[model samples]
Target: MNKLPYIFSLVVLLSTSFGPSSAQAQERRGWSPQAKGAVIGAGSGAVLGAVINKRNRAVGGVVGGVAGGAVGYGVGKHIDNKQKERARIAAANRAAAARNAEYRRSLARRNARQTVAPTRLQPAAMPGNSLVAGSAAMAYDAQGNPVPYASNAAYLPNDAYGDASHPYSTSEYRRKSW
Candidate 1:
C-alpha cells in the first residue's frame, strides 16, 4: 500500500514534468536537441535515483534530475552552436561562389566585345591608286563590299573644274602663259 502511493506520485511527477514540455516543443516545430536531451536526462536520472535510494527516492530523484539536466543542456547547446557555425560558413562560401561566377560572366562578356573585329568605314589604302584632293575616296561596308565615300557630297563641286566659267577654274593661269 505504501509502494502504491509512491508509484502513483512518481507517475504524476513524470507526467507533469514531461507532458507539457513535449507538447510545447511539438507546437513550436519539433523538439530542439536541448529539449530532447533534457527530457531523456530527467527520466533516466529519476529511474536511476529511485533504484539507488530505496529509503528516500524523491530527494535522490530531484538531485539526480537537476544534475543530469544541466549536463544534457550543455552538450545539446554545444551541438546546436556547432551546427549553426557550419551553416554560416556554408552560406558564406555559396555567396562567394555566386559572386565569382558573376565576375567570370562579366569578364567573358568584356573579352568577347574586345576580341571582335571592328567594322571599317573607309579603306586604309587603294591599291595602284593615289588619293586626289578633290575626288571621292573609296569606302567599305561591314561586309567588305565597296561603297561610296560618306563625304562624297563635299567633292561634288570639283566636277565643275572641267568648265572654264566655274569659280575654281584655272583660265587666268592659262592666259598668263606661266
Candidate 2:
C-alpha cells in the first residue's frame, strides 16, 4: 500500500507549474508567492492528512492537499497586490521629489537675476592723471563682473572732471593740485 507515487502526482497537479511547456520565459520570474505557498501547503497538508486519517490515507492526502493549496494561493495573491501598490506609491513620490528639486533650481536662478546687479568698477581714467582718484584714475575692468558705465568717461569725485558747479569744486578743479 505504498501511496508515495500517488501523493507525489497529486502534489504536482495542484502546483502552479507542472512542467516547462513554452519556449519564452514567464513574465514574473522565479517562484511567485502563490506558487511557493501552494507547494509548501501541499507538502504539509499531505503529511498531516496521512497522519490523521488512519484508514484511506491516500484519499485524505489528496483532498487535504487540494484544499491547502487553494488557501495558500489566496494568501499569496493578497501579498502580491500589496507589494505592487507599494511600488506604485514609491514611484509617485520619486516623481514628486524630482519636480520639487527642479522648481527650487528655477527659483534660485530667477532670484539671482533680480537681486544681483552688475557691479561698477573703479572710476574711469582722465588724461594728464590730474585725478588719480582710485588710480589716474585709470579704472580696471570689473574682473569677471560686468561694468555698467562707459569705459572712456572719467568718473571723478567732487565733479573734478565733469560739472564744475559741484558743492565741493573750486575753479582749480581740473588743475593738478598734487
Candidate 3:
C-alpha cells in the first residue's frame, strides 16, 4: 500500500543520515593516546580557526593544532635539558669554590707559622722565672737542694717596694722631672 512505500522511504532516509555518524564513531573508537590527543587538538584548533576565518577553517585548525603540539613538546624538552645543564654547572662551581676555600685555609696556616716566632729553649739551671728548659742543680729549696723545674713556668716578679699596706701603689714607670 501507499503507507508501506512511505515507511520504506523513511527507513532509507534515516539510514543515509545515521550511516556516516556510525562510521565516524567507529573511526574514533580505540584510538591510541597520541592519536586521540592529536584529534582533540585538531578539533580545538579547527574551532578556533573557524572563529578566525570564514574559509578553510577545518584545514587551518588541523595545521595549527599539530604545530602547537609539536612546538610545545620541543620547547618542554629544551627547557628540561637547559635546567639539567644549569644544575651541572652550579655543582661544578660549588665544588671549585670548596676547593679554593680549602687551599686558602692551608695557605693561611703556613703563612702564620712562618710569620710567628718559635718558643726558645734554654738550660734548665737558669730557671730564674724565665722560659728556660733543662735546668741543672738550679732552683734551691730551703735546705739548699737543687730541684728540677718545669720547662714553662709562670714568671713571678718580686715587688721589692710593695708591702701588705700598699698593695696597689707599685708603678713600673719613672716619674718625669719638670
Candidate 4:
C-alpha cells in the first residue's frame, strides 16, 4: 500500500510537469509583469518573422521588443489603478470621520446648553417692593412720633402650618406676594 502511494505521487509530478494548459503553467509559475512581457515578446517575434524578412531575425527582435514594452506599460497602469482606488477610500474615510466628529461636538454643545438654567433672562422680584409706604401725616400722634398700626405688617401670620423655627416661608418671597 505504501508503494502504491509513492507510485501515485510520482504520476502526479509527471502529469504536472508535462501539462499543456496555461492555467496549470500559471499555478506552477507566478504571474508577473516581467513574465507576461517575455511571453508577449516571444509570440510577437514569431508572428512578425515572415513579413519583414525571409530570414526574419531582425524584424522578429524589433516586434518582440515593442510587445514587451506594451506589456510593461499595461502592468504599470494596473498598479497605478490599484493605488488610486486605495487613496480614494482613505480620503472618504477621513471625510466621514470629520463629519461624525462635528456632529458629536454640536450635540454635546446643545446638551450643555439645555442642562444650564436661564437665570439671567428674567428680573428678580422682592417681597416688600410693591407695598406702599405709610404716610406720617395720617398716623402721627401729638408728640410727632408716627403711631404704630396693624396695617404696617409686612405679611399675614401662617399660624402653626409651617416649622416653628422657620417662621418665614421662602415661597412668599419667591413669588413676591404677602
Candidate 5:
C-alpha cells in the first residue's frame, strides 16, 4: 500500500516535468535538438536510476536526471550553434556569388559597348544656294537627316537682333516687364 503512493507520486512528478517540453515540441515546426536531447536524457536517466538504486528510486532518479539534463543541454547547444554558424556562412557565400554574377554582367555590357562603333553626327543637307557656317552649326534627326535652323537670322554672326548679351537686347529688356 505504501508503494502505491510512491508510484503515483513518481508518475505525477515525471508527467509534470515533461508536460511543458512536450507541448513546446508539438507547437514547433520541427523538433529542436535541445528538446530531443532533454527527452532522451530524462528517459535514460530514469531507467538508469531505477536499475542502479532499487531501494531509493526517487532520489536516484532526481540526481541522475539533473546530471543528464546538464550534459544534454551542453551538447545540444553546441550543435545548434554550429548549425547556425554554417547557415550564416552559406548565406554569405550565396550573396557573394550573386554580387559576382552582377559584376560579370556589368563587365560584359561595358565590353559590348566598347566593341561597337560610335555613331557620328551627320552633315546638314543645306540647299545649294544657302550658306552655312560649318558642320559645327549642324544638327541631325534620328535617321541622320539634317535639321534646318528655325531662322537664318539667328545664326548670323554680327546681327544685332541675335546678340542677346548686348545691353539693349530685347531679351534683357523684356524680362523687366515680368
Candidate 6:
C-alpha cells in the first residue's frame, strides 16, 4: 500500500522535526540575561501549563508562557541595572584614585624643584662687609622662621638713590669713605 509508506514517512518526519536536539541543550553564549530568562520562563511555564490543564492544553500553554516570560524578563532587567550601577561606582572610585596619585606626584616634583641647600651667611661675607645695625634679610629658612644676622656697623643710606656710573662720586661712597 502506497498510503502505508506515506503514513510511515509522515510519522518519521514529525517525530524528528519536533524532537529535542543537542543544539537546544547547549547554552547560548551571546544571549543576554533577560533573553535567557524569558526563554527559560516560557519553556517551563508551557510545560507546567500543559500538565495542569487537561482540556485546552494549547490555550493554557500560551497564556502561561506569556505571563511567565514577562515576569522573568522584569526580574532579569532589574539584575542587569544593579550590575551596571555597581560597575559605574567602581570605575569612578578608580578614576578618583588615579587623579589623587597624580596630584601627589606633582606636589613631590614641585617641592623637589623648590628645595634649596643651606647656606651660612655672615656679616663679613655681606656685600658691604657688614649688615645694617638693625636690618635683616627678607629670606626665610625651610620651616619659615626668621634668621637674623646682626652687626655693630653703622646704618647705610638707601642704595636705590646711588648712580651706577658714579659709585665713587656719591657722598655715601666717595673716595676714602667707608
TM-score leader: 5
Tens digit of lDDT per residue, candidate 5, span 58-83? 77887787777777777778889999
TM-score of 5: 0.52
Q: How accurate is candidate 4 locally (lDDT)?
A: 0.57
- How does candidate 6 score on lDDT? 0.70
TM-score, predicted candidate 2 vs. hidden true structure: 0.51
Weakest lDDT window of 10 consecutive positions for candidate 3: 169-178
Candidate that beats the other on lDDT, 3 or 5, i.e. the better one: 5
TM-score for each of the candidates? 0.51, 0.51, 0.32, 0.35, 0.52, 0.50
Tens digit of per-residue lDDT, candidate 2, span 67-139: 8788788888888889999999999999999999999999999988875544545544455523333342233
lDDT per residue (tens digit) for residues 69-113 in model 3: 665555556666787899999999999999999999999999988
Instruction: Please give the CA lDDT of all the candidate structures.
Output: 0.69, 0.66, 0.59, 0.57, 0.67, 0.70
lDDT of 1 by residue, 33-116 (tens): 888778777778877887788899888888778877877787788888998999999999999999999999999999988655
Q: What is the lDDT of residue 62 in candidate 6?
A: 80
> If the candidates were sorted by their lDDT against the true structure, best first, what order would they fall in?
6, 1, 5, 2, 3, 4
Model 4 agreement with the true structure over 1-178: per-residue lDDT tens digits? 7479659967997998686766654546565645565556555654564346557665665665566566655765676678789999999999999999999999999998865432222222323533545431224444455443333445443443455465464333212254
Question: Candidate 6 residues 1-178, lDDT tens each?
Answer: 8479659977997988798777986775687779878888887887888788889887788888888888788877888899899999999999999999999999999998996767544333344555354443543466656454333334433343466565543555233245
Candidate 6 regions exceeding 4 Å error are 1-29, 116-178
| TM-score of structure candidate 4 | 0.35
Candidate 4: residue pairs that collide:
none
Please give the lDDT score at residue 28 for candidate 5: 53
Q: Model 5 clash tally?
A: 0
Candidate 5 ranges with C-alpha deviation above 4 Å? 4-28, 115-178
Instruction: Indicate the worst ten consecutive residues by lDDT in candidate 1.
Output: 169-178
Q: Flag regions of model 3 displaced more than 4 Å.
A: 1-62, 113-178
